[model samples]
Each structure stands twice: as C-alpha cells, then as structure tokens.
Target: MSKRHISLKDLANELKVSISTVSRALKNHPDISPELTLKIQKLAADWNYTPNPLAMGLLRQQTKMIGVIVPDIVTHFYASIISGIEEVAKQHGYYIVIASSNESLQKEIESVENLLKSRVEGFIVCLSQETNKYDHFEKLNSNEIPLVFFDRICESLDVPSVVVDGVEATKKITRHFYENGCKRIAYISGPEHLNISKNRKVGYLEGLKECGLKFDPQFLVTCNLSTKDATRATRQLLTNKILPDAIFGLNDTIAFAAMKEIKNQGLKIPDDIALVGFTDEFHSTVVEPSLTSVTHPTFKMGQEAANLFFKCIRNGKGFSEKIELKADLIIRESTLK
Candidate 1:
C-alpha cells in the first residue's frame, strides 16, 4: 500500500486552521504570524509536502510555464539555446515546455495551437524554414500573450528578438578565404525565403567587393539546406569550367556535405579548395580537416530571448526590441595552407 500525498487541505485539517490560513502560512505571507508560519513549515517538512504547481497557478491566474518552439531540437545549437532558457526560467520560479517544428510551417502552427491550449504564459520561438506567413504569431500578439523570437525570425512582425549579425559574420568568413589567396570564392546558399540565407549572400558579395574580387554569377548556388542538396550543389560547382578556389556553405551541415563531395571529387582541402562554413557545429572539429567557421552565440541568444519575454510580461504589453549579438570567426585546418 502507498501513503497518500499531503495537500494544503490536509495540512489545514491537521493544524485546525482554514485552508487559506494554511496557504498563507506556507508562503510566509505577512498577515500570518511568524510562530504560525514556523509551525506550518515544520509540519510541511515532516509530511514532505510539495505545493502543486497547477493548483498554485490556478490561484494566481498564471501557468508559470513558458512555451519554446524551435526548428529542430536535435541540432546542438537549438539544444544549447534551450539550456540557456531553462537556466533563467528556473531562476524565476518558472518552467518551460518545448516543441520542435522540424522546419515545417504546418508543424509550427500546430505547436503554437497546442501550447496555447496548455495555457502557457508566454512563448519563445525560432521560426521554421517554411514559416513565411506571420498570421499564427500575429494571433498570439493580438491576444496580448508575451512572445519572443530568437535566431531565424520574421522581420515583418513587431516583436522582441535576439539574433547574431549574420551579414557581418559571413562577410568576415569570406574575407578570410580571400586573404588565403583564393582568387575565386563560391557560396552554397539555402532557400532565398530564409532571412539568414539572404543576409549571408549579401555579405559574401560585399566581402568580394572589399577583396577586389569580381562577383561571378556562376559561383553562386542555392539548395534546400539538406545534405543531399548540398552535395549536388558542390558537384555542380566542381564541374564548372572555372572551378572556385574556395567554397562556403551557409551552415556547417551543408559545409560538411560539401567537404565529403569535394573529397570524393579528388580535391585536397585548402591545397586545392579552401572551405568555410557558418554556425560552428560540433562535428566541425571531428572532420578529416577541422572546419573553419563562424561561431554563433546560441546559448546567450536563448537567454536573451527568454529575458525579453519576461520583460514583456512585466510591462503588460509588447514593445519591439531587436537585440543583436556578435559571432566569432574560428579558423581551422580546413582554411590553413
């Protein structure tokens, strides 16, 4: 047989006090005498009483639970971000519920609907690859529910967001390749609809201009950000009559695929074709030649997003805030001669 868990009602009955009195005493409310509070604390300790979050939230009209939605949870970047969010949430006596959209617009919409049904007090999100329309997020804003975005965000929407400067980060990487004596630089990009992709492309062009390298139309290739797609893009670039001396992928995942394909084509890294990628993923170090890439402040970005959501909640209204964090360039064997 199992012992029954103690509740406030049970405590009140044992102490011969009202349920409200027991609640106040347990919380150390000012109205409750110190002696009574101490008595309640001792009894609570003896019974191993733990206040139910759901019951307490009902009384306060707050769930004390923040909802987090990301493109993919399996990615280490997003996982680190979630860690940062959880750290700050625990400090504020709040918890979080997480959902992954798998880069699909429909899944993102469903996640939003389901989290709302759970009565989450706020939301932190990173938009999906196919999330161009802002209707679902707009609805959350219309209802005055506090929401914050991180990383891949919707620029058209008026909301608080935390992101790194994609343009500057990519520009630095492109310049690094030029300094390594790469006359021709090629960039493998993702879908045009993604803001990160657009910003990175712009940066690549600007970096070329700075290096006195002419932009070649044939050097730019777009793919779906999948490994297979990236491999195809790399093969296409390799087949060009004038092959690029260097290749840059929008992210490490694509870059890894590009590296594999480049090797398969009998090219030596840096000696034949220098390679660079963004978002310094964990696998970058374990590859045949360590990848040179841009390091995103993913954990800090998550903390800022959650902090922004809390700020909105305290203010009782949304005020647009755009917080941009800096990214670092990490040079590795892949880019070294």
Candidate 2:
C-alpha cells in the first residue's frame, strides 16, 4: 500500500512537541526557539508537507474567496466579465465562486444563501432581469458583507456598482437613426422595473426631443427580453397605423427576434425599417445585415466591480460608491440607411 501523507499530529508526535508548537515552529514564530523552528521547517520540507487552505481559513476567519453572480454564463458578455474579474482576483491572491441566477429571483436568493454557507468573504453580482425585490441583498448589507454590483444593479441600495451609461448609449442610437433620415423611430424596451430599460427609455425620449420629434406612445413597446415577446412587440409596432421607420431593441436577443419578424412581414431592413440593438454580441457581425448595437466595456466593467469589492472589504462597513462606464454605438448594415 502507498504511504499516507504525514499530518501535523504525526510531526508533533515524532518531534515530542504539541501540534500547536509544531505549527508555530513551522511558521517561524518568534516565540518558538530558533533551533526548534529550523527543525520543524526541515521536517516539513522533507515530508513534502503543505498546510490546508480551508483549515487555515477557518482558523483565521478569512476565506479569501469571493462569490460572483450573473444572469447567465453562456453569453460572451458575462464570460468576458468573469475573465476580467478573475484577473483582478488572482492579483490579490483571492478566488471567485461563481453562480448564475438564470434571470430568476428565487434562484438568485438561493445562490446568495449557498455562497454565504461557503463562507465567501464577499460578493460581486449582476442582478437578474426578474429580480424586482431587494430583501435578499438587504440582509447582506445589514450584515456588512463586502458586496459590489455590476451592470444590472439595485440603485436604491447603498452598495457600490459599476455600469455603463445606457441612457447616453440609447441617445446616440436615436440620434444616429434621426441622422439617417428616419423620422418615425421606435424603441423596444425590457420590463419596466429594470434599470437598464428605464435609463435607455430616458435616453430615447431625450433623443427624440433633441431631434425635434414628438414622443409617440404607440411607437414604444415592452418585452420580457425573450424572443417570442420581442417578436410579438415587433409585430404590434409593424401593424400600427403609422409604421416606425427605425427600431431599437433593448438587447441583441430582442433585436434578432425583431429582425426575423420584420423579414417574416416582408419588410426590407434599412429600406422599410432600420434597426439597432444593445450589447454587441459576436453573432451581430455574422448575422445577415450586421446589426447596429451598443458596445459595452464589459471587461472593464468587471475589473471595476472587482476593484470596488476589494475596496469595500478594506474600508469596512457602510461604504458605497458608484462607477459609470461609457458605451459606443456601433453602426452597421442594419442601421446604415
């Protein structure tokens, strides 16, 4: 049978000392005699001994592990953000525990509980689309856990957050549409409760006013950010008495759905109706008539969120700040007209 790795107890027994003494000696604690420290160090080296991270963490009450939550992990958007977060985490000798809410509030709550049980030192989160309540997060805030949010976040909470200026991005898209000679511009928004939808709607209205165009309630519609809902919204807009000459979807998923629905109705893109989307996904380039979209600084947003989390850890309780990043409108074939 293969030999088992020796434990601290074995080392203590062999050296005729207590386990605590062996541990302190290995650490070269000043309280340990120089001779005993050398002996313990040599024995540890010869035995190929290593301290257990989990055990040490329990002893010191420092996990050095951060919990991270996002809407979903399949998209390049969240993946890129995770990469950036990991980069920062490694620099600080910390690890991240990731969880996906999958756009469900219940799942988000469960994830929070599970990560807390894991004893993660802190959390970095992007609220799910369906997360309308803040009670689950409020508990962490009340307990003074190191927490930072990114992208979709709770603005009411006194927690640090990193996000893009959706308002300005949408405004840019609207102005681009107007400059392209589209008068009846429409915007497809997400749920009313989402901060993203609210911010973009503000920008859309501002853009319309800036272009000297009156706001038409019929031109704006809401979707659940799903393909079917987006397609239905698109159909509703198309069937209006005065059809929109341009359309902007809250995200690529919505835009792709709108594209299909528009094609189904025999409408020519950038001819009968121009289109744009937010979150420039990779598929945007490969799709026929490449979609115009808002390119967010996802990686940077991740880095900022991680940095903010560490800052909160250092500053201790009741610390909060907000960081806003900028996004650019990538004009493409779909909006060229």
Report the number of the highest-TM-score candidate: 2
lDDT of 1 by residue, 245-273 (tens): 99999999989999999999999998999
- Whole-model Cα lDDT of every candidate shown, in order: 0.87, 0.89
In candidate 2, where is summed lDDT lowest over 10 consecutive residues? 50-59
Which runs of model 1 end up more than 4 angstroms from their true locations?
Answer: 1-60
Inter-residue clash pairs, candidate 1 = none
Question: Per-prediction RMSD in angstroms?
Answer: 13.4, 12.8
lDDT of 1: 0.87
Worst-scoring 10-residue span by lDDT in model 1? 51-60
Candidate 2 lDDT, tens digit per residue, 1-337?
Answer: 1134457887898889999999998877999999999998888777655454223334247778999999999888899999999999999999999999999999999998788778788789999999999977875676567889998899889899998999899889999999999999999999899889999999999999999999999999999988899999999999999999999999999999999999999999989999998999999998888999999998998899999988997888778989999999888999886
